[model samples]
Target: MAMNGETKTKAKSNLSKRGSKALTPFSPYIDAVNQAKSCQWSPSNEEGFFLMATAESVLSFDLVHEKIRTCREVPATVGLYGNFRGGDRLRSAIAKMMERTFMGVEVNSAHICISSGVTAVLDLFFFATCDPGDGCLIPAPYFPAFDNDMSIRNEVQPIPVQPADTHTYIPTAEEMEKAVVEAAKRGVKPRVLLITNPGNPLGTLYPEATLKELLLWAVNRGLHVLSDEIYANSKFGSSPDEFISMEKVAQNAVLENLLSAELVAEFVHTAYGMSKDFGMNGFRVGSLHTRSKDLLNFWQNMGMFAAVSNDTQHALAVMLEDENFVDSYVSENKRRLKKSYELLTTNFKTANLHFMSACAAMFCWLDLRSVLAESTFKAESELWKEILEECHIVLTPGEACHYGEPGFFRVCYASMPPNQLQVACDRLTAFIEKKRRKRKAANIS
Candidate 1:
C-alpha cells in the first residue's frame, strides 16, 4: 500500500464558493421521492406494493395519445431556444383555457410565462420579487416540496403561517397578517403570501370571501400574493364553496374598483401547471400569469434557464387549442377522480379512520389521532414507520407537509387503480386493528 517511491496521488481540489449551497444535502421531500422511486411497483416488486407517497393524477387514462396529436410542425421548434416569456400559441391556449373553462375573465397571453414546471416558475418568481433571506408566508398543512423550492438555491425561506388550533387547521386573514408580523419580528422580511387553492395537503377549496380577506391582508402589507391554481380543473365536489380562481377575483376587483388597478398589477401573481390538471407530468410544462409588465420583460430576457421544451410546447398547444376535446377530457378526469375518492372514503370510514373529504387533488388528509400510541409527533413517526415497513406501503407523514398537528397523513386516492386502492385500505385497517389489540393488552396488564 506504500506509494512513497512507486506512485504519487493527486491532492484534492477545493469546491467553489457557492458549493455549500449548491452541494448541500437534499431536503426531506427529496428523501421521500427517492424512497418512492426505489420502492416503485414492478413485476419483481409487485409483492411489495407502493401506496402513493407523492401527489400525482390517476394514470388509468386511455387519452394520452390525444395530448400530442401531431408532429407536423413540432420539429420546427427543436432548433431554437424559443421565447423566454413562452411561445405565443401555447400561451394563448392557456389563457383561453383559463377564460373559458376555469376563470371567468380573459387572460392576456403576453403576461403568461411558461417554464419546465411550477417549481421552476416559483424559483423565477421568487427571485424577481424577493432578495436573499426574505421569506414567503405559507399556511401550514402546505405542500412539503415548497420548503426547498423556495430557498434551497435562492436563499429565500418559507415562513410557515401556523394555525391557532390543530384539528381545524385553517388560517384566517388575521393569522396571515400575524404571521407576517412574526416573521418581521424575527428579522425575516415576508415578501409574499403563497396559497394552494384546492390545497395540496388539506385537499379543501378556498372560498371567495376567504380569498378576498387574505388578499386584503397581503395588500395591506404590500406583499405579493402567489395563488397556486394547479388543480383548477380537478374539482368534483358538490359543495357550494367550490373552486375559485384568483385571477377571476383580481379581474373582478379591477372592474368594480374595489382594489386599485395599480395594486392588482403590482401584487397579484398566479401559477398553474399541466402535471396535475392534464395528467401530463412527463411534459414538464407550467404557466405563471401576472399583470406586471416589468416582471414579464425580465422573464422574457432571462427565463431560458427553465423554458419549456419546444416540442412539448407544440404538442400542448395542439391539445389546449381544441376546446371541445379539452372540455370532455377535463370532465372525464373529474368523474374518474370522484369515483376513486368515494371508494377511498368508504374504506376509511369502514375502518373508523376519519378523513377530510376534499374538493380537489388526489389526497385524503387522514386524522390518525385515535390510534396514536401517544399524542406526539415522535409517536406518529413510529406509527408511520411500522406501516411503511410491515405493510410494505408508503404514506406521507403530516409532519413532512408542515402540518401543525401530530397525527395526520396524506393518502393519494388517484395514483393507483381502484382495486389496488381497495387493497391499500385493507392493509391500513389491519394496521389499525393490530395497534388496537396492543393497546387492549397493555390495559389488561
Candidate 2:
C-alpha cells in the first residue's frame, strides 16, 4: 500500500522534544468497544460507566435552556477575546461558591485563573513549577489520566505513595516521606504533593487531621501541595463527617502556627471544575485557585492558550448566580449520588463482596481479590476481560491505574440510573457465582 502524504510526512519528520512525545492512544475500554462495535451487547458507549460520567445527576439539558432564555439579560458587550483570568463575572461567581465551601478562607476572583479543563490547568501548573525529570507525590490507585497529562509531554513523574497499610490504603506522613525517599533513590526529585480530596476512584475524603499531617509534611519538605478538590461539592454521605477543603486546612494551619500565613499561601494550590460537580464535562471550564501571585500571573499571561469561550463562561456564570436553581441542583444531585451509593453498597452486601467505605466522588474502590484465580496483574487483566466481554459492563481494574497491587477495581455508580445499576449488579453477581461454581466443580473433578 502506498503511504499517504500525511503518513509520509510523519515518517520523515523530525519533531521537537515536546512534539516528539510518544502518543499513548491506548485505552482498554476503547479497544474493547471498538472490537465489539459491529455487534455490541450494550450499544451505547455510555454503558462503559467506569468513565465517571454523571450525566443523570443534574438536569443540565433544561438548565442550559434556561441559560438561553436569560441570554438577553447579559449586556451587549464584545467578548471576542476573553479576559485571561476568565470572565470577570465568572471568576467572581467561582470565588463566591468556593468561599461558601471553605468559609473564612480568603479567596478573591483576582487570585483565580481559569483554563479549559482541570487537565489543562494541571499541565500548565506542572510546567510552571516543575522542571523536566521532576516528580510529584500521588497516592496509589489514583486517576490514571494524570500519567498522560502530567508526565508524557511535561516529564513530571507521578511517584505513587503507597499507604502504610496496604490493605486499607490510608495515606500518611510516614508514607509520604518514604515515597519521597524512594523517588530520591531513583534520582527523581519530588517537588509537589498532589492530593485528590474526595478522591477519584476511591471516592473517599481525607480527614482533617490527615490533611493537616500531609500539609505539614509538604511544608516541611518544601513541597507544593496541589489539592485537587474537583469533587468538593459532590460529597454525599450521611455520616457526621463532611468533605473538608484544604483551603480551610491551610487557614487553620496558619492560625495554629503550624505554618506561617505566607508559607500557607505560597505552598497550597487547588484545581476545581464544573465537570465533576455539575456534570458539565463538555463545557471545558475549570479553574486554578491559588494565592501565589507568581503562579497566578504566569497562568494569566498564558491563559489564552486554552481559554474557555466567553459565551460558555457567561452561561455558566449566570447559572451559578441563580442561588435558587443552584440550591435545587445541589440537593437533587446529592440525593441521586447518595441513592446510587446506597444501592450499590447494598448489592455488594448481598453478594458478600467487600468495598472501601466512601462518601465522595463518583465511584467506589471494590475489593475483588477473592475472585482472582491468582495474585497477579495478569489475573486481574483476565478477570477484567471476562467481565467486560461477557457482561457488557465496565469497571476499571487496579492495574490500569498503575496500582502497586492487583484484584481491586473501580466501579463508577453515579453515571447511570437505578435500573441500569440493577442490571450491572445482576451481571456481576452472576459472574461471581459462575466463578464459584467452577471452583466447586474443579474440586469435585
Indicate which candidate wins on TM-score.
1
Which runs in model 1 stand beyond 4 Å of their true positions? 1-18, 21-29, 42-44, 69-77, 165-168
Q: Evaluate model 2: give its lDDT.
A: 0.77
RMSD of each: 5.7, 4.4
The lDDT for every candidate, in the order shown, is 0.79, 0.77
Question: Clashing residue pairs, candidate 1?
Answer: none
Clashes of each: 0, 0
lDDT of 1 by residue, 129-183 (tens): 9999999999888887787678876779898878786555667888887887788
The Cα error of candidate 1 at residue 164, in Å, is 2.8
lDDT comparing candidate 1 with the true structure: 0.79
TM-score of each: 0.92, 0.90
